[model samples]
Target: MNRRNFIQLLGVGAGATILSSTLIGCGGEPHVELFGWSGPAATLKDIRLKVLSYAILAPNPHNKQPWIVKLVGPSSFALYVDPNRLLPATDPYYRQVHIGQGTFLEIASIAASALGYKANIHYFPEGQYGNKALANKPVALLELTEAPNVKPDPLFDHLLNRHSNKRSYDRTSLSPNEEQLLQTFHQKTSDAELVFKSSAQDQTQLTGFLTEAMAIETGNKARDEETIAMFRVNQAEVEKYRDGFGVAQAGMSGVKKIVAETFFLSREKLEKNPAGFGEQAVDITHAAAESTATFAWLTTKSNQRIDQIKIGRDYCRINLQTTAMGLAQHPMSQILQEYDDMLPLQKSFKEGYGIVPNDTVQMLFRLGRAKPTTHSPRRTLDSIISV
Candidate 1:
């Protein structure tokens, strides 16, 4: 990628090439074929549906698009967490689930902007739910009003292009100018603290922390099965479910993905006996950490329902911003999760890194240059919308 595209990807200026659904926003990469990557179809005449078509592309934990919409009026809707679709094992407090909700909202708002509509959002319309649990209350109520004077969001150019890259990086570090631009962009977007580390000592400590965190996270029966249940074993399943992830989302492609699926990967067998699946998760997590040269994180003063959702929005925007910079971004947040068995390690990590005991490290991710992976699939928008 050129330096011009690199700076644009980091949101330094306004020039960006709008992409069609077939393009993965990687500048010169091959054309992609995922329906979810496509923009609002020509057939989507309704304004609300058009915006929602893009909202479904929002990234979420483990590709579980945990969102439910109740159409409230001709131009508004209520958003809720799909109680049935959550990562209770890894996200024991539904923090990541709420973050997913924020990502969906951010995408919808950006889509609305590109089409001359202002998305008016009201959070927790009924009442605030508990910080650590799910409730029936709607997450937000969105009202769209046409705004002829509104400028299209530049981030919209990257809607279909943005993705969570999950492959080996090229081992390049961000220049001082690039890092400063990112820090400034993040500070302007949210109040959360943005921390970037790229030293050799930092990499050694973090890769170890991340590798051990994955081991602890996947060392349980329920947790391993939760991930396996969502694993699409092959393309047949990828097209069949139109959701979850497989080798494609993990940076495997063509013959490698095919061979792995045919010979080694079996969803049914893994689901029944998931011990082996955890081993792969550990290996992949450690390798991903070692492959990258830079790491960043977001932390907040407290952990509440609203805080999680707000940070989710912040995290999603940072992901998009990185995409614009002609760089690859991936979240390696296994060590940031809140679970009993993982607390000791989490505490050690925070203290070692100078994060205060009371503060919550909401997001932890690796960043570098790498080839983009296939977009994670999404079920039909109708599946998420309950009339």
Candidate 2:
């Protein structure tokens, strides 16, 4: 089916509950064809879906599995963004959506590699006439090729094992080689930048900036609401939806509960008292910011949608790679994505990196070695794929 028909079907048939069911699978026909010669081995057709299960498990902002997959003749499958799952308010330009799409592509590509196929993906096709939203953008087409017998990227194994480590990181700094390896992920992307802050003083500075940035994000009425909506407050809801940001089961338990409750309470008050709610929002956002280590930004020369997705894919790749090196990544994107709250943080970033306004920053994340944390949940492969 064409993307337009698929989108229309979604609009008419998939309500919220159906959306949820679609993620985990209810009673429905298989959406993808099983065999093809161009993509992966025919034997893999039976198990490629299983391999994609691992990629679906990758973390995305708010557990939004903003991706759609179609097996095109056996050798190739196209991945597209799910417009219904976008965070239009905060991600006005759909930058987060694009990044999330990139993350999904990288996960599938890596998983394909592990399963003995080299997945070749090309971003938005240049010539296509169809639904404007789906047609113009890049489509990550995974074509199976003979896998190279190279040493496994320790990270390939960690794909399932890795999760964003949101808690405090150990004070020990990363070795030069580890840092270089992480940097190498993005060095090839002309429109990106990576800065590693390991010194105590720099770490302290980053922590302070993050604290302040978080405060501003959470304080703003619109931004806070956007974030809160994506948060799956309870473990039950988290498990059922199979997507969302949840407090790691291994981290400080009471902390996630307290934060979730506090936000819930604050959200209630915001409905009744706007002024008071605004002040509280700022306070909470700032407090949340102060809790991190190093800072890094993924910048581009232009702020187009495709570039953002590329930035996102590269970001996920680097983070997963870092996890392999026993390191962690913390996002401090409030400064880059939220204008009002993160102004101070932006100034600091530009000053620190000697960056100019002409250059666009697509992602801002921090890195360190931290204790392992809980992995974010994902929607099932059956939900994302179609024949």
Most accurate candidate by lDDT: 1
Model 1 per-residue lDDT tens digits across residues 200-283: 888889999999999998899988888888899987888888778876665776655666677767777788768777777777
TM-score of 1: 0.91
Off by over 4 Å in 1: 1-31, 35-38
Q: List per-candidate RMSD values in Å.
A: 6.8, 11.4
User: If scored against the real structure, what TM-score would every candidate get?
Assistant: 0.91, 0.73
Q: Write the per-residue lDDT of candidate 2 for residues 110-172, one digit (tens) a residue.
A: 776666677777766554323214443445666666676733444566664456655554456
Task: Indicate the residue-level lDDT of 160 in model 1.
Answer: 71
Each model's lDDT comes to 0.81, 0.58
